[model samples]
Target chain A: MLQKRIIVCLDVRDGKTTKGVKFKGNVDIGDPVLMAEEYYKQGVDELVFYDITASSEKRGIMIDIVKKVAEKIFIPFSVGGGIRTLSDMKQVILAGAEKVSVNSSAVKNPSIISEGAKHFGKQCIVVGMDVEMDFSKPSGYGIVINGGRTKVDLDALEWAKKIEKLGAGEIVLNSIDADGTKNGYEIKLTRMISESVGIPVVASGGAGTSMHLADVFNEGKADAALIASMVHIDGYTVGGIKEFLNKENIPVRI
Target chain B: MKIGILNYDAGNLKSVETALAHLGAKYFVSSDPYELAKSDKLIFPGVGEAQSSMKILKKRGLDIFLREYFKKGNPILGICLGCQIVLDSSEERNTKCVGLVPGNSKEFSHNMDLKIPHMGWNQVQSTNNHYIFKDIPNNSSFYFVHSYYPDPDNQNAVIALTDYGISFSSAFSVDNLVAVQFHPEKSGPHGLKLLDNFISKTQGV
Candidate 1:
């Protein structure tokens, strides 16, 4: 059976790992390399490093961190944020990251997704969608970009389908409404995107407890859950979460 | 001690190289058949489409080199697409592969509810006590990212099986050649352990 993955997402700013609430008020937590190694030791299924300060000025720094993290952690990890060009994608992959995710840039120049997928196999390309609830949109969720600050006219479900067709092997569907809230995952939104896309959908944001993780997997139909505060601040270990999910009869790597 | 990572313009070989470096093993990445042939062991790591990969491998004469190298009985480890191409053929684009092993690579059926690419960690049940699986627990999950799987013509060639809507060979050993449908390099600690076993244990089967 294919186990549902529990991925730890680290938001990196400058060189330190930071966590912000609803993409605001971020505070430095720890070194991403060390934290990544610790979580890798604790048996996190995968790790995602998002360069929160995703600007052209900070790309060199992110690449350096990515190289350091790659050397220490053997598990699969994805690097996102500020990845706008094919050259950026190549630099990250050469730095040893398995997958390179493009979010806002993907929305701006949708061709970047197809270009990245063509240059590197689709498996190497991940489309990180930051979606917010908007009943006016056809899917009732509108695409938000620029770190959830700007709302776009695109529909979430339609965009997901387009990216899949554009050769995005995986979709990291992060609900802006549920992000950093700890209220629980937006199951309705997640299920809609997960069911609509043939590719694997990783439910990101709003993971408060192990139950929430289980709920996202079961009710939300999420293939994987991207967690932050639960493990980063709430003192939940990856192994402990996996054990709880195991008890819940959800297939997890144990 | 020299580990040559065969690079036939397949995909990113950085992860494989980084993993080997972390293992403190001296290695080189090369597409040149002569350079790769000189290594004591060869690690064939690949990603991307089989048809295009075959084109590059043929252009560089890596296909012939790999077959000859396998015939020599030198220890070779194949990962993901590397594992698939070792088979006789692949249902992916109706492509033919290097016939070192006795099977064909078949695509996972979309008719089933599961995703086409069986991506993620899945348990691999060891069918044979092959040395490649030494110290690795039975039913331990390894990271996988692929649409097609190696389907050996001979059941005996299969040393491990995994189920994802169907039972398929996740790992197989035929004499000195060992291949896995999963990426052990990216599979965390146990994955590193498998790579260690492949590198340290000179003999296979």
Candidate 2:
């Protein structure tokens, strides 16, 4: 049986692992390599490095950080944000990222996803969707881009299905409204997207406690859960979370 | 002494490098036939279309060089796409391969819940207890990402088997040439142990 993944997310800026509330009010955490190694030692299944920076500054710093982390950690690492082209995906993968997650760039040019999947294999491409519930819209939730600052009219579920068709190996359903809330994952939203897509779904955002993770796995039926705030603040170690989940009979890497 | 990783413009070489480094083994990335031939051991790692990779290998004369080097009993390990290339042929693009191993690769068409390109980690059921799996726990899972798998004609060539809609040859060893369908480099400690075993076994070969 496939085990559920416990992923630790690092919001990197200028080569540092920084964290913020709801994608604003950022605070410098530390060097990405150091943080990545720390998470690896704690037995995190995977690591996600989101380069929360402008497009121009993203390439060099992201590559440098990937090289640094890849040097210290042997676990699967994913780099996202400002990944615009196939060359960008190749650069990161060559630099040592096992998977490249694209959001805004993939949306603007959806063919990039198919081209990337064709070139690097589908497992190498990850589509990160930043979604929020829009009561005004018919589907309730709308897809957002540019660090969740702009809401596109496209329905979140519709976009997910389209990207899956476009050859995205996995979908990271990140709830913008639930991000940094630390209450729990947006169960309904995550579940909706997970059920809608045939591929693996990684639930991101608003993971607070062990129960929250259990809820995501049990209710959302997610293959993996991406946690940042709780782990970064020492609220829960990766091992602790896994142990907790394991006690609950949830299959997690231990 | 650095291990030479054949850079065939295919597969995830950096991950292989990281796995080797974790085992405290020094390695260098190279596609130069001379550089590869002189190394202690060679890792023919790849991940791409079979025809294109075979084209690159032939254009660089690596195909001939690898065959010659293997005849000398040099230890060479192939991973994923690398493993497929060792076979006689591949269904991917209907391309002929290095033919180092007595097998042919084919695509999966089995009606199963799993998708094509079997991604994520899976366990290997060892066949005959080889040195490569020494100290590695049984039913240990390793990361796998591929669409096609090798079907070896010789059953003895198989070292392990894994089920993905169907049981397939997960690992094979014939003399100095060994290959794995899974990426041991991407796998964790278990994978590093396999690399370490290869290094120790091939150190003086």
Candidate 3:
């Protein structure tokens, strides 16, 4: 049976992690590598790093950060933010990221999806969708890009189907409507997208507690759940989340 | 011990190199098979299309080199697509593979609901006390991402099995050769240990 993955997300700006990702139980936490190592020790299934800086100079620095983190963590991790071309994707992969995610850039030029998938197998490309619920749209959700600054004509469901056809290996569905709310995952939206596509769906955004993650997996049928704020700010650790999920009959890699 | 990490300019080379470095094991990554000649053992790791990947191997003359390397049978570990290539042939793009093991690689039946490339962490049940799994725990999970699996003509060679939609061979262990459908370098501590096992055991033998 495929185990439901609990991925820890790190928001890195310049070279350091944006906000201090503290582990209540562990005191040895300062840098991204330390935090990542702490999570790895707890057996966090995977990790995701978003290059919040996204500047040309900072991206080169981010590559160094990726290399440092890769040296410490063994599991697979994906790098996103400011990944514009095939070379950008290759840099992260060579620096040791197993996958590269594209959101706004991919929206602008959809060919990057197929081009990337062709250059470096479909497994390497992830189409990350930031979706916002809209009653005006037929699917009740619209694609948002540029950090929710712009909205596209594409319906969430239609885009989900299109990205899969374009040879995207996975879809990371994040709800702009429920993001940073500390409520729970948009189960309705997640389920809708998860069921609509053949590829795996990673439910992201709006996770406040471990129970919220379980809900996404059990109800939304998400192959994986991306947790950031809940674990980052809240006094939660990856081990704590997995332990909670395990009791709920969600097979996490404990 | 000196280890040869055979790089085909494909998947997980850096991660594998990082894992080997963490182990404090002496290793080098090179596209040239000749570079691996002086090493004690080899790790064949690949991730990508089987058809195109096979062409590169033949282009580099690695297909010939690997077959010769296998005949000597010191120790070589094939990972994911690298593992599939050790078989007789693959259904992927109707590609012929190096036949180190008696088997053929077949794509998992297109079970639409279940993901085609079974990508995630999953349990691996050890079938026999294979040396490659020396210190690893039983029923431990390893990371896997592949649509095609090797159906070994000889079932006894299968060292481990994992079920996605059905029971499939996740790994095979035969004399001086071990191949896995999962990525050990990406599979965390247990995975690192599996590589360590392959290293320590191969050198001792």
Q: What DockQ would you assign to candidate 1?
A: 0.87
Q: After superposing candidate 1, which stretches have Cα over 4 Å from the reference? A: none
Q: What fraction of the genuine interface contacts, i.e. the true contacts, does candidate 3 reproduce?
A: 0.84
Candidate with the larger DockQ of 1 and 3:
1
Look at candidate 3 and give me any clashing residue pairs: none
DockQ per candidate:
0.87, 0.47, 0.83
Alpha-carbon shift of residue A44 in model 1 (angstroms)? 0.3
Compared with the true structure, the alpha-carbon lDDT of candidate 3 equals 0.87
Q: What does the lDDT read for residue B51 in candidate 3?
A: 85
Residue B85, candidate 3: C-alpha displacement in angstroms: 0.5
CAPRI rating of model 2: acceptable
**Chain A TM-score values for every predicted structure, listed in order:** 0.98, 0.97, 0.94
Tell me the alpha-carbon RMSD of every candidate: 1.1, 2.5, 3.1
Output the lDDT of residue B10, model 2. 86
What is the C-alpha lDDT profile of model 2 across A1-254, one tens digit per residue?
A: 45788888898887777899987889997888888888888888788999887557446877888998888877788999888888889899989999999998988899999999898878889999999998876668998998888877888888999998998889999999999888889999888888777688899989888999999999998888999878888577888999999999997756
Q: For every candidate, what share of the true interface contacts is present?
A: 0.85, 0.38, 0.84
